[model samples]
Target: MKYFFAIIYIITTVAINAQETHKRTLKLMGSRFDITVVANNKTEADTYIDIAVTEISRIEKLISSWDENSQTSKINRNAGIKAVHVDKELFDLIERAIQISKLTDGAFDISYASMDRIWKFDGSVTKMPTPENIKASVAKVGYQHIILDKEKQTVFLKIKGMKIGFGAIGKGYAADKAKQLLKQKGVQAGIINASGDMNTWGTQTNGDQWKVGITNPMNKNNVFALLPISERAVVTSGNYEKYIMINGKRYSHIIDPRTGYPSSGIVSVSVFAPSAELADALATSVFVMGKDVGLNFINQLKGIECIIVDEKGKIVHSTNIDIQDKLKNE
Candidate 1:
């Protein structure tokens, strides 16, 4: 199995010949969600798409840290005071995030929300932050400080201001849940794209595989390759749009939780995995780990492949990926 982060934002799904593919674009979870499904009739497609929208909304209510009434907000409100009991679904998600944190050695941390906004990429700051300021920014970021009580189904933060936010992994998790809900309802094929976090199952109406175009980071308009996929998740994390160039160095919006510094050297990291949730978090982790370390880590994982584009626009893939056949014919 091969995987890559294609320029999904610029390419829409296409079908060969005439086919009935119903699609709806909506704003959900604070991102552009394009939900497409293949069905024999419009009513069936609309109904199934509604089910997906409802499922994704339910997840947002349970995990959104920004909403005061959400369980996640409640967990943050009581930080350093007491453990807040939560629903089984939210609890399990947090538990899995903690496990990923350990796997990446704090590079992928949910506690990153507590980081201070000392560095800005809005073209505001002219000089790099002082060493002391950078050190102080991540004072509250440590995955070990998050205490999860499995028996009580509660979450506790060891510090008063420490918080957990799913900005990096939430959309992918939402996409995965939505896809599972649709499949359970007997929907044969569809694509759930939560911003750039996408999940697909089955083929198109014409029986052709789903084609995803990989965008060249150096030349954004040109697609370097086209990857055919089915029943898998593809997530791309890149700093190309959100970054600041200072003294000829490009600093991305993705920050390294370990150092409180913006990740540099890599422009984009696309991950392919069994689920969008894992792919989303791992893609961000690869950005922080850089090319050598990131490629090695991805190669060791089973059923996970990644494509990393370095600062110089050179493309690198995991050990299993071969570009001979994946390059787009067009």
Candidate 2:
């Protein structure tokens, strides 16, 4: 599940003389990417945006499981057959994904790609899967079975038919990488919004901090708060858009890989962190962790905050974030 954000800005007198904000929205990595850059003119902004597009495309080819020639596909094809050597970048990404799996106690697992897709979010489903079928659906899904060789920079899956994919983290990682490359090229301020995974650097053209309006889960067209963020990443995972009802109960599209069942109890989770990659992973993790456990887990981590909206429309936030002050309707 992904959420959308509204970019808020207050025009100032400096806008006429200062660098202007140029944005281009295009399709990249099978998702919509809105790349915005602050530049003196349109040509320079287009140049910077093109560079970011190239970088994002490169990352997609490296990690996309659908592309048969990608290194990730090679690794999946050789599962339980042999250890396939991969580039250091891909190897390191897999290693970090494993670390996150352990930290979340298996709440977040790339190996979840191997699970059978028994739960459909489309409106056609009228009932739920049985206990036995649900249990067997996740038989091949286990991160513990994934083996990494640091010496050879190889990845090996111990079980046949086991695979891994980065649907949750790939876009955010691409956004972070694009932002990094643009920054190195002296693009002072920009935003790479890969759907709802947003990363911002520097400030707006008017020298004001970039702000994003948090969408109200109860009403998709309304916003509850507008929070100013600088040099940070924010990601929101919500079930409001994609979910199914069975026996008058709603089940989110975000399935818990361990149980082979869709997640419940929470409607949305928004996480703020230093990087979009971390924020993306944590947002999904919080949904699976439930409201209470997720809030506790986030409170323990420094430099990280989250806001959760339960099914009852009740809102709760981490220790560091004060939503009351940012409420747009207040």
Candidate 3:
């Protein structure tokens, strides 16, 4: 009996000290995703991430506005004629996007895709567009145009050619859903990095917290900070990464729906929230809204913080934000 008790104690000790790391990376939705977890075994961690990916893929099939057969596409197709029933998740996402649009004073709009692609940042772009061209671009860009029926769970685009998409927000939504799915699947430690939007939970295998690197907008190969965080999502949006430079000026792909022009003043916006989905959408909103209003908007919200960096590298932070260290070799 004494030997049995001793063996039991040793087994418990081993269990306490033992941790396994699992990582799974895959390409889906035209992006790269890396998920890692520290669990009792490698298989469990991988399984958790796989489950999350499956959930994301299912949502993509249902909600992708680009996919012609998707429910959202069907809604766009049936505009002005009939209301198309949609998945509950897609309905919820659109509703949240509309709310964000209202909260940001139309800075965050899903209908921006309906705008004309007039202000191209390509090398071919020459002189500024005429006032009429700029005015016409925002013609179909309005959140009020999206009509959703609660009882029927249906969506309708009020105007023909007016469309909605999750380009700026889908990856974050995927990350958030994956995180919740991971937790439900008995995962204690893991992270879902859907491109620049990422969420993490619990500790690492070494008993230390997870460290996330914020990529430097100025330095492509450097990180601005090494944040030791858990149970939080970080999203970064920057023009320096995907913008086109012409006439000694840079134009970002992220357009402001209210102005029908690309955002100016702010260069990058990083938001930390409870979930990646929220963080992602809010980051883009803040970027287009500029520093003052954007930071104020984020600070007013609970559990949301932002770091705004301008073209000159001057940083403005929300109420509870931290930038531990600047980028090395920037």
Q: TM-score winner among the candidates? A: 2
Per-residue CA lDDT of model 2 for 130-223, tens digit only, reads: 9999999999888899999999999999998999999889999999999999999999998898887889998887788887777657866666
> Mind giving the per-residue lDDT tens digits that candidate 3 earns over 1-330?
000000000000112456876777787666777777767776666677678889879777876878899987888788767788888888999999999888878888888778888876555776667888988988888999899899999988888878787887888888888888888878887777776677888877666777666554555455556666789988776776555565676666678887777776777777888888788778888878778888888889998887767776666678776657753434
**TM-scores of all candidate predictions against the true structure:** 0.93, 0.94, 0.88
Candidate 3 or 1, higher lDDT:
1
Model 2 weakest 10-residue run by lDDT: 5-14
What is the clash count for each candidate, in the order shown? 0, 0, 0
lDDT of 1 by residue, 1-330 (tens): 011234664234455554478899999988888899887778989999999999999999989988999999988888899999999999999999999999999889998998999988789977889989999999989989999999999999999899899988898999999999999999988999888788999887778778777776777886776677789998987777778888899888888998988888988888888899999999989988888999999999998998877888887789876443454322
TM-score of 2: 0.94
- Model 2: lDDT to the true structure: 0.85
Error of 3 at 92 (Å): 1.4
lDDT, model 3, position 277: 77
Q: What count of clashes does model 1 give?
A: 0
Per-residue error for 241 in candidate 3, Å, reads: 3.1
Cα deviation of 161, candidate 3, in Å: 1.2
